[model samples]
Target chain A: SQTIHQWPATLVQPVGSPLSLECTVEGTSNPNLYWYRQAAGRGLQLLFYSVGIGQISSEVPQNLSASRPQDRQFILSSKKLLLSDSGFYLCVGTRFSYEQYFGPGTRLTVT
Target chain B: SQQGEEDPQALSIQEGENATMNCSYKTSINNLQWYRQNSGRGLVHLILIRSNEREKHSGRLRVTLDTSKKSSSLLITASRAADTASYFCAVTDSWGKFQFGAGTQVVVTP
Candidate 1:
């Protein structure tokens, strides 16, 4: 059984502050990783995805960036947060192609 | 945008009743997947129906896909209070690009 974990389940930060969210998957290697953000009362928007280490694809050009420093570790970061950045962020790991498993998610509030 | 669209943005049903949601997309797809999201939580993949397949079942859930119509439907039988969540249908293109619909929020009352 594989498990996906995310840190800082909830965050509240002022505009222009730096942001860092980490996601790790245990029991799987070379898995596809994705970052998605959901605005309140809205559908999810894919921010970034990685096929392998140091290979990140941006679905939507945004202020946030993603890094796959390790095979099982994926991180979402921002040098400066925007008020529009306030939303729920999700980390997903897919094994065997397309069966995606998601983490608990982090709620970010940019004040 | 070729993103999928779910009908009945919101739905409320009594416990033990059936709940149905429809999703329509415009484009060729390799597969369509259904996911459930509890309030303010991450999504959980429910089922995936390949373009070659028309229907699939898992436990009390039934999913039907019509490639000709570019549509899909999800039916949850004997719904429970725990079934209250948002349902989203995601379409995956041949290149493995995935796009999700706005989603249908379902509420099952006891």
Candidate 2:
């Protein structure tokens, strides 16, 4: 079983401030990691995905970026925050299976 | 663009009744999965149906898939208040990338 851990479950940041959200996976190696954002009462939008270290793919061009420094560590960063960036962020991890394990998620509120 | 689109963006049903939601997709897929998410929480995998399968059952949940139609349906039998949540359908392409639908908000009243 793979467990995904995300830090700072809730965050409130001002516009133009920087942002950093972290996700780590356990019990899996070289797994595919994904970053998603969900607006209030809406479906998820894939922001980025990483298949390996230093390899990141952006599904939608946005103010967010993703990095995979290690096999099990994935990070979401932003140089400056935008009011539209406020949403619930989720981190997912998966091996070769169609099943994806999701983290508890972080609630970001850009003020 | 999203590959899957769920019908009946919202549903309201009483307890002990059955709730059904439909999902339609645009392209070929390797598998389709259903997930449930409570308020302010992460999504939990509910069930998965492959392209070759027609129907699958898991406890009170039933899933039907039609490849020719490029659609699927999820039925929740004898629903409870605990079942009140947002249900999403995700389609996995041949490349294993998953695209999620907007979801159906099911509210089971007691």
Candidate 3:
């Protein structure tokens, strides 16, 4: 079975600080990866998706960006975090069946 | 703009009652998927129904798709308190990109 892992289950960063969230998948290679953000009481907004290393398709324009450094590793980074950047960030990978498997998620609170 | 819209923004039902939520989308879809999220956490995959399929069942959940009308519904039978969560409908286009709906919040009272 495949498993997705995300680091720093929770974080509290001050406004304008740099941010980094990492996600990795085990038991799979070259899988489609996605990053999503869900604001409180709102639907998920797609941030970025990568089909391969160094290839990213952004869905929404924002202060956040995503990178795929390795086959199974993805990172979400921001040079200067804003208050609006606080939300629950999710990392997802598509299973062989075409359904998505999500990581535990990282809750970032920028104050 | 959202490609899919789920009806009944919120639903409250008893533990033994059945809960049904509907989703409507624009344009053609290759597949429609249902997901559940607890609080503000990541979404968990529930079920997926291909455009060619009319209905599918898994455990206590049933999903029906109408390609002609571009709509889908999810039925949860004999719900439990643990089923209290927000449910979302996602549609995949021909290129396999997933678009999610606003989600329907379901509250199962015990």
Worst lDDT run of 10 residues, candidate 1 chain A, spans A93-102
DockQ of each: 0.42, 0.56, 0.49
lDDT of each: 0.89, 0.91, 0.89
lDDT of 2 by residue, A1-111 (tens): 899999889999999999999999998888888888999988888788888999999988888889999999999999999999999999988766476788889999999
By summed lDDT, the worst window of 10 consecutive residues in model 3 chain B runs over: B91-100
CA deviation > 4 Å runs, candidate 2: none
**Candidate 1, A13-108: lDDT as tens digits:** 999999999999998788888888999988888888888899998888889999999999999999999999999998887765366677889999
Question: Model 1 misses residue B23 by how many Å?
Answer: 1.9
Residue B29, candidate 2: Cα error in Å is: 2.3
Off by over 4 Å in 1: B14-17, B26-30
Clash pairs of candidate 2?
none
Which residue pairs show backbone clashes in model 1? none
Encode model 2's per-residue lDDT on B1-110: one tens digit a residue. 66789989999999999999999999889889999999868788899998889999999999999999999999999999999999999888776677788899999999
Candidate 1 lDDT score at position A82: 99
Among all candidates shown, the one with the greatest DockQ: 2
User: TM-score of every model?
Assistant: 0.85, 0.93, 0.89
- The all-Cα superposition gives candidate 3 an RMSD in Å to the true structure of 2.0
